[model samples]
Target: MVCDMSSDIFSRQLDFSKFDLIYAGAQKNMGPAGTTLVVVKEDVLGKVSRKIPSMMDYKVHISKGSMFNTPPVFAVYTSMLTMQWLKDLGGIKAIEEENDKKARLIYSEIDLNPLFKGYAVKEDRSNMNATFTLENENLKETFDAMWKEAGINGLNGHRSVGGYRASMYNALSLDSVKVLVEVMSDLESKA
Candidate 1:
């Protein structure tokens, strides 16, 4: 199966072998959005009967060492640097552990805090993205101000799921999540 793992690519451990192709944009957990990374098994190519252009051909890209045309040099370099950083942090397995801890911290607070409610089922919750909502919709403005004042941003959820989404990526530290939890607790105190 082809998987678009843009948000959780290197943030968690994954069994890539199960996927025929895996692709991700560098913006979320790797680097900038200009670059995308794709992996495909060689055997899977040439199976399609349709004609594939050289630009869209995976085999062609691979044969050209992923330099078929001018690449986003800066984005590629940044992605390489981020990958190296992840490697130094002991690779995917280690980063997954750190990501899990961060998720658990915020999720625990969401469960404990009466003012907030998580959107996903416990068993299906994502380690990278914690979607939640304020129990009282009116309290959103107050909580937004609180988190903003505490130097927290990007907690806004998608329009379809209008609540909050706290992304605990590999690079996010535990202390950051603690700050969020403290903000949540403070909001609860004021409630």
Candidate 2:
């Protein structure tokens, strides 16, 4: 009964047999925004006590071959291209390894750096989004400037959670992760 929509999707593996319904917003690990890829065990629809709106119902979308309305063409096409690229790279199995390496590199710094603290519990840390915060809030402005100067962007955390979030998606390379780590380490040295 867990409706998990945490946005990892393609970046992390999940057992579909364990989930009656799983939804992923394409903007995260997939393509652009305005599209959501959903997988559901159809039987679960039968148990819904309330009526679902046509636009929001999975059954409708499935029945129409996902053409229930004017879909986001750009997002859908880009998502398809992303999937093809991933497949060519030996699919999820291969990308998962690269992702693990990137996560390890950054998390190692987050752990070793005295000026920073990881936001997620060590065991529950996400491979896609490694979140961490400053040990000294006073250093926020300085750290922000430092990372930006290092050519890092989109390093901000989710609006609901204020800190920093390093997104290690499928296409992000080990070298990119290294640059971020270097910036973090630089921050530590300067602190």
Candidate 3:
């Protein structure tokens, strides 16, 4: 039940023993969007006596080696490539540091900017998706216009949660975060 919602997994300070399962979408920190990851203790598996359908059952998938009806072919292939890329880039430890640095810059900018405010509680806020909004509602139009002008795309927030969300996934570098901070700073000066 304990989810480390942070982007940089290495920055997680959670006590993993407390959780029954650990789940993460590969798209965010690991790989592309199509693949999902679940790691559960072997002892925790057979306790659910409910008759779960084949595809819906983790035990079945685990038994079948995840080749439950051919599986997501392209997603698995891409995921393999991403894992190799991670290995080549010095693995999880190195990537975690880079991700942390990127998140810090973006969060720092959002925190310091008078006009902008982050969405989540400080501790619960995701380092991957830095969700925030302009305090002056009138500035929404202006901010959208500015990001468009700067050739920045996908900074828009999810409709479920109004405002802006800069998703700095693993592939997104510190340089990209710096560029985004510069944009925020520029906008703040104008405001």
Q: Number of clashing residue pairs in every model?
A: 0, 0, 0
Candidate number that wins on TM-score, 1 or 2:
1
Instruction: Tell me which residue pairs clash in candidate 3.
Output: none
Tens digits of per-residue lDDT, candidate 1, 1-191, equal 99999989988777899999999988989988899999999989888799988888889899898889999999999999999999999998898889889988999999999899999999999988899999998988899999999999999999897899998877789999999999999999999
Global CA lDDT of candidate 1, please? 0.91
- A best-first ranking of the candidates according to their lDDT comes to 1, 2, 3
Q: Can you tell me which runs of candidate 1 are displaced by over 4 Å? A: none
Q: What ranges in model 2 sit over 4 Å off?
A: none
What is each predicted model's overall lDDT from 0 to 1?
Answer: 0.91, 0.85, 0.77
Clashes of 1: 0
Clashes in predicted model 2? 0
Select the stronger candidate by TM-score from 2 and 3. 2
| Pairs clashing within candidate 1 | none
Better of 1 and 3 by lDDT: 1
Q: Which stretch of 10 consecutive residues in model 3 shows the poorest summed lDDT? A: 4-13
lDDT of 2 by residue, 23-122 (tens): 8788777787887888898888756789888888888888999898999888889999998988898877888888999999999999999988999999
- Compared to the true structure, candidate 2 yields what TM-score? 0.91
Q: If scored against the real structure, what TM-score would every candidate get? A: 0.95, 0.91, 0.86
Q: Which candidate has the top score in lDDT?
A: 1
